[model samples]
Target: MAARRHTTTRRPVLAAAAAFLLPPNPVAAAERLAFDDLYSGWSVMGASFSPRLLALVGQEAALRGYMAPPLKAEADFFVLAREPMALCPFCSSDADWPVDIVVVYLRRQAQPTDPGTRIEVVGRVETGSWTDPDSGFVSQIRLRDARFRPL
Candidate 1:
């Protein structure tokens, strides 16, 4: 009887095969858009959407920012700001919103969270200025049918 010996050369091939069989990463499919990339020109009137933003309209996109408090306890929308907002803009009259803030409308109701928490949001990019008929919140950029996770 002869003892069997294992060959190390097959390990690489097996590893590659296993990797190929795995599902594709969801993050790779989403186009990452930074807060800086949201605007191109700033004027006394208002900021203009960048070319990158224009091209990404109606496409899947991802943004990372702090999750501001929701407008109401039952509302499905919240504000995503460049920095952690100390006060809820919707609730406080004196809370000045950022010029480049993104209004995020969740696909489903999200649990109330602390305003200081950092989060990564994924959704379809919506460009152009539009006012939410319900909340009357005006925004230049928005993420519709969005979902988020803590960063």
Candidate 2:
């Protein structure tokens, strides 16, 4: 008896269906950002936003950093710093702010992770200086509607 090759259109259909069933890849979907990548240079005025960072402005991006302790146990936002900071920068003067820090505004209020804990945050990037109306916090950069997970 002669053997015949087996093929079916159902394979493609099933694969398409499976793709929809699978959860989206967060890492793949977001542009990875870094503290060192945030700036191009600094003048007497302040740090300049790097071309890479500016390009990500108004777009969804991700960055890994240490979470600074938030003012409240649970809040809608927190600060992410290159290195773990013990004190709340928000509670102090602007002079105390870390060089590599950016505000992360969460999508919802949740318990803040321990200070210095490394985590990856994903959100829409915003550039230029902006102040939080509710908290009276000023930030050069921010990640809006962000969510984070431990790295």
Candidate 3:
């Protein structure tokens, strides 16, 4: 018996099929939890991360959401929102996103996704308060060194 090589046609077909069958990956995927499941409580002052979220800190999390407009024309960080925000959370001093938003810090600047495009963000969850020194925006929960793409 002789060894044989695979054809390129089969390789492309297999690659395409693999892309569809697999869930969207961001950095790496861990146990998936919905945005609704991120917080156990929501309030004006702040929200508490659900035990599920708190327990997953420093672990990868996959959160599905839309990309909100960044505070600056360019930002090191972006916000993933459950819904398209009509107002700017940073520009509009009174505006604020839901407590569950996952503040995504991309390894590098990524082309902003469509506001309507649903994206999956994955990164190590950081649970606590932090302010963006450049923007002064406050966040209770964030996903550091995150990456995302349309779902």
Candidate 4:
């Protein structure tokens, strides 16, 4: 008669166990925000940004929206809107820019999706009025170093 013993590797087991000890970051990952959550209220003049939205500035966040038509088929930036729009949000004028729209500046040029295609974007949230130097596009809210995928 004979007896056999089995052995298991410790490295993998130790690595898996170590992961549990690490603290989780509340904002380590992008937080999902809704179009409706962008503003606090509306008026003939304009809407105000909600405290929650303003508080997210400089933090990574995600937004789901439809891509507005871009100035070029492949461009470094585009506008995202709550609903599909026939024209770029900044095409008309700054005053006409919708509160529900957010300018998305990509890490690199990207082929914008069709106007009707829904997409989700992740990037650093930026708030405050700023104008693009090249296109002369004006925006109050923006997502910088962003990436998007079809929804």
Ranking of predictions according to TM-score: 1, 2, 3, 4
TM-scores of the candidates in the order shown: 0.76, 0.76, 0.74, 0.73
The candidate 2 region of ten consecutive residues with least summed lDDT is 1-10
Going through the candidates in the order shown, the clash numbers are 0, 0, 0, 0
Residue 96 displacement in candidate 4 (angstroms): 4.8
lDDT by residue (1-151, candidate 2, tens digit) is 1221122234345535644776553544676777888998988787889988998989998888988878556678788898888655578765687866899999988788877578988899998878888778788999998988776
Q: Tens digit of lDDT per residue, candidate 3, span 3-121?
A: 21244235446545655788634323354557877888878876777888898899877788888877676656988888876765567655556656667887677788788888877
- The all-Cα superposition gives candidate 1 an RMSD in Å to the true structure of 12.1
Estimate, for each residue in 1-151, the C-alpha lDDT of model 4 and write its tens digit: 1221111244335435544564532222566678877898999998899877898999888888988878556778898899887644567764565567899999778887888999888889999898988778888899999888785
Output the TM-score of candidate 1.
Answer: 0.76
Q: Mind giving the per-residue lDDT tens digits that candidate 1 earns over 1-151?
A: 1221233345446545644775533444566778988998999987889888899999988888998777778658888999988865577664467789999998899795677888878889998889889888888889998888775
**Ten consecutive residues with minimal summed lDDT in candidate 4?**
1-10
Error of 4 at 24 (Å): 18
Model 2 RMSD to the real structure? 11.3
Candidate 3 global CA lDDT score: 0.73
TM-score of candidate 4 relative to the true fold: 0.73
Q: Score candidate 1 by lDDT.
A: 0.79
Q: Model 2 segments beyond 4 Å from truth?
A: 1-25, 87-95
| lDDT by candidate, in order shown | 0.79, 0.79, 0.73, 0.77
